[model samples]
Target chain A: MSMFPIIMWILMVVVAFVIYIPVAIKINKTGLKRLGATAHIFTCDPDKDPIK
Target chain B: MSIYLGVFIGYFAIIIISSIVGAKKVETMGDFTTGGNSMGLILGVGTSVATWLSVASVMGVPGNIYSRGVCAITGWIAGWFGGTALMPLIAYKIRRPAVPTRTFPEFIHARYDADKDVSPLQIVAAVIELAGYFVFSFIQVQGFGIVLNRITGLPFVTCCWLFMIILVFTCFGGFQSVARTDTVNAILILIGVIAGAITVVNVAGGMGAIVENFATTTAPAVTGGNPIPAGSLTSTWGVFGASAIMSTFLSNSLGASVAPHWVARFMAPKNAKTGALQMFWVVIFLIPIFICIVIIGMGGKALMPSLPEGVTSDYMFPQLIINYLNPVLGSLALVAICAAAVSTANSMLLHCSTSLIYDIVRNIKFSGGKKATVEDDAKTTKVLRITILVLGVLAVIGAIQQWSFLADGFTYVYGAFGSVFFAMVWLGLYVKKMNRPAAWVSLIVGFILYFYCVTQGAPFGLPTFIVSGGCSVISAIIVMLVTKAPPVECYEAYFSDDPSEATVAAMHRIRRDDV
Candidate 1:
């Protein structure tokens, strides 16, 4: 009678994201090490990065 | 009026809108170009593998089984098989500190930042690889056009343009959207293709009846010219060279693992190990011969016996699906086919866009000689999006020209780049003595020879690979020699034993005495 399936669908997506979060962090962590204009896609030299 | 065509467009609208809205967060250059280095293992592997295995591969593969026997089994298949099998073993070998900093060219540029000895090869590799990718990408879009035209009442060129617009929107989400959509698209293909295969087999009264039908079907008695003289399309070994060719073709696909988008698959997981494992499985599932797509092609040869001569063998599979499967089921399969074409072209469009903007266009110096760095993240995003559109347009224009063979269009060009950079990059990782100059010499030799061979092969259908590969390897070695390389440490020279361990001990005793 209750709308339980929608709750389950939301939970599944959340779980997938929870598992995926660390992997994304690792990729970003690696990207931070690269340096150049767009020669490299994700990287910016850490030493040069104002953000870092 | 075709049910499949309508369904395909319906799905296209949903996915494209989803892509643009979901990817709105990609406000930086990196996000637009590489999905901001944030794809999961499954999505990356799924999309990369799905894009690699396209409608042409799905249809063309089984046609090989029909027209030629085991020989249809060669190059990309064999290479991919070997590569997948070898993946886990070498995954770590490919994991480098600078990967995030690398585009395909950036990787080559760094890995082979050849000493004074090794520079030319890198440039050659870059140029050739880019060219190979460009042609393959163009054909992929064209393959979509063919499938769409066959299913719908629309003009082929119009279908191509419509699909091309879909392609841009899909890529508008950048790497993340592409991967997610492709993962869904691939599963749909697996299901649709399998359904199409079962229906075809059922209609034909199972495998035995189909085989029997195939055996009875003979060529209308040979015309006066005696086409393909002294050979039989009747056997697998004749024109197809099923075994040797199968191995060669599969071997060539190993070369794909190193392609720009494919290798980027390595960047999507917790680590290279996880990504490599995903790739390993993707290869097994996506083998040109394994699944329903290929089966559909064989089904077509049996079920559609009345298919006229010169009906473009590639169209046979789609024709069978449209005629035999239920309208809705057929529509699903058609969507899968269109999706396959669009996804691959999109991937190629992304790679070429990245290369042109990041490598070719941006690298060009001003008339007064000034360069700009990544000044605004938002601006960079806009530029890459524009680059994707520009490349998409160029490829669409090229697709309308109607090439004779999709497979033929890509191979020679890929081989040119593959011969030099493929060998050099692998060696650069392992062989310390190989200098940068050697890479350069090999590149010049490889590109010129490969270009010449491609022209000649156009008329004669000769191989560019063996010719270009042979020259590049020889030249690379010669340049290595001319550089007067130093003797690298071997088993004989582990280290200077600290000028004698005993002498060191004696010196320690004298120091103790002084103390």
Candidate 2:
């Protein structure tokens, strides 16, 4: 209920978002499109599969 | 009883509702295992954080801080946080494999599959994973039982069974259900930590008083028959001393990257970047929660010097909520505590069961020269549910017997997972020479060394993880050089030189090269 505790909680949020959001966004925009292709399901012949 | 009943019923209702909602999205084995590999950043991060913050994070770390010192944060909490930093080393590489694998062991099976058949090494790895996760799940139930026993005055075994039933029912819908419910648990855990911290801070007469007390308060001369050195609260080494703390830090720092439950989360992300980026959000959300737990542990120590004789320090966190906060809020916090345990327990159980059915059983069926059929989606789902039920029952039986082997030595199970898989998986991703023989040798050496060190009481205060993991990696490298290297196709299928489409294609071309 005190202003100090409320201030502490808000500061934690603000600091974390300020640091994280930008990096996340940049990665999403530039890094994601490229990584998306790599993450696509790789089709393979069943007999050639190492684990099959 | 009324407040607790209402809180628990409400919690179960939310979990069931999420299960029903998520069940609609699960139509295939992939969906059942990895949520259809369509999880966006938010859901992926939410579930990751929730699953990672097991009872160890919620109760064990705080209890350690309460009894030992702030170094518990450095050793246990900070170590876990640091583990996420290592995730990028394998995240995109593992996620971008030429083919998607359902379980961590399946990835190992696919990557190190000798002779294009189910590798014996893969089956051994699955067995280890199943055993590790079974103990992990058992501890969750054990933690839950301890709290419920204290609160309800019920026998511990009864409480264990009660939680076992609830956890199994909640996870019956499998990964989708677990993910949706975990998202909810993640939110509640955040709220609970904040609420608990605020209450503790206010009770301790604000942050200034708490800090002053922590700075000035001497650790009790005797804690549960163990002598506590003076001024451990602020000391860097604290009661456990530097070598033990450092060892724990090194071992736990790899916990997230190698643990089967956490590894499964990487497979669910919508894209490679999402898998990599999820670590950032998990750490961001965890930072405040980490700060709050530090306050609770330190602040509680400042206020309540010691528990009555016979009560373990593990009771510190739950007792704070039960005694200090308002009944309604206390009950909510209790739900969060139970949520923490159940959220993690469900995920581990799911991973363990998947390893049993899809990873081990299916491989056996295929190896028996049984002709492979198109896996019937409905049958797979039914078999998976049955597996979940069976594993849950086994976990309940294990939970009833107090395994001091695991419960007392908190770091051993985690150390085993890290020691066994840390070098093998990470090295296998980048080094084309990492063959199945080397992996097998590494795993065997790691297991023997860790258990031998642990049985010898981790002689000279060196941590089991470093000793085992070091020996394992060294032996693996030596073995890889002596044995024939795996064909280039093994490397091509599992890794890309870089996270680019062109590189992926190049890798695949080599993967498909004529034998």
Candidate 3:
């Protein structure tokens, strides 16, 4: 098995976790239904209550 | 006759019974469509994985691996894993408002409407979703036809009709039943694939021997390429070259994230935490199954050097099961393939129905177009069920052909969803000033460009996804920069305000039958 592809997969996973986990944790903390604010992932409704 | 009848009948009975029991919960559109947005983490994970693993992953991936080697994993499987990993970032947003949206297209309708009523963007988005998901459901029915023909010796067309009957019973229970039934299917798939992998590995004289044989085996000449030489198994881009591999990876990863059935799963979760956690568990569950997928395909190649005169790589799994494993065990494995296909087909059908009845029809009837009354909701539920039945029959008709257009059709289906929605959903979700014109232009361009590429064989070896997806993103961005955004309140409804909070609290507190 070439380690190159496996390593590339590992990197992709790491990046996904880095981007997703923090937002997930924030959503959990706010007790809010929507992300309630954008740490990341853009919202089409940008004109509304702008997250700090 | 080959040990499938008794097992399949019993399996179908359990699915029907559970689906009926779950159907008892469907008193309103909320119940039928999003399960009242009350799905627990367990069912959420189960349905999500079952929906994600479809016939394509279970049957198609193995076929690819058998023909093209490990590059299949990089091209297809890796993209799925990668795409799903990003789902958490959008899960909460997609399932927005404590009240939750019934379908994905509803989100587009909610976000982009100008007067807080139905808009052209909403209708167009829902129509695209309906068309795309309808085709997806057809492919799953075709997959079921393949398996049924193998087991029962029925004509392919007859098998397609038989599976269509199964879909009605399975889909009639609505989202609640679909989620519950999916849990059962997911468990079966996990067990079947794991067992099938172990049996394939052992039959081929262990993993090391299988690997040795694969490295030295020569591929038979097929329509796509010249015979692949020994040791070329290690080459990432053998006959397909870099572009083909990249195309698979792009469509599988990017296109999948927006697949209607997948987005529908997020809507059913009990809460944001439930949705977010679902992705984690999905990845956990998929790992073993995917490893098994690789083993089955690669191992089959090791043992059989060349398929029997008429067989294609698509038959590798069923061939391994029947020819190698004991009868009882093979029957159990076959159930897994059935489970994978049924779970995906039912979910796709459900989404298609919801888009037709819940998003499009319901939007037309509502004044603010934001909420549906109890009577209106009940009427839509009836419509949704009827739609599911009618769509099931249409899918059966699509499956009557002998050739499994699944491989090529799968790319077109995913690419269609990606081109039409990927830009719209992503931009609609994040970009501040993406105006209606931008959304419209991007959608139209992506739709036309994708079909054009498909018609021309994806010129220069470029995948349909890159052609369409690139057009969607680039055009949306360019247009958004020049066009004025929609009104600020439109943005608030989707992003800033908790519009569904009162309704959610009322539903939880009063349990009102009347809307």
RMSD value for candidate 2: 7.2
- Once fitted onto the true fold, the runs of candidate 3 whose alpha carbons sit more than 4 angstroms away are A1-5, A29-52, B114-116, B221-226, B365-372, B402-407, B457-463, B497-515
lDDT of 2 at B178: 88
Give a tens-digit lDDT track for model 3, residues B1-515. 64678889888998888798889988877778889877776788888889877888888888777877777777777778877887876676676554455677666655565444456776777788888888888888888888878877889789888888878787888988988888899989988888889889888999999888877778662333456788776566655777777777788778878776677677777666567668866877888888898898888787666666565667667777878877777888888988988998998898888888766776676644245558766777888889999999988887765345455566667778888888777777677586778888888998898889877767777776888899899999999898787766445544643544533433222222233
Off by over 4 Å in 1: A1-52, B25-27, B83-91, B114-126, B220-236, B241-251, B268-270, B287-289, B364-374, B452-464, B481-515
Candidate whose TM-score is highest: 3
Better of 1 and 2 by TM-score: 2
Worst 10 residues of 3 chain B by lDDT: B506-515
Instruction: Considering the two chains of model 1, state its CAPRI-style docking category.
Output: incorrect
Off by over 4 Å in 2: A1-34, A37-52, B218-227, B368-377, B404-410, B458-461, B497-515
Output the better candidate (1/3) by lDDT. Answer: 3
Among these predicted structures, which one has the highest DockQ? Answer: 3
- Order the candidate numbers by TM-score, best to worst: 3, 2, 1
**Given candidate 1, what's the lDDT at residue B227?**
33
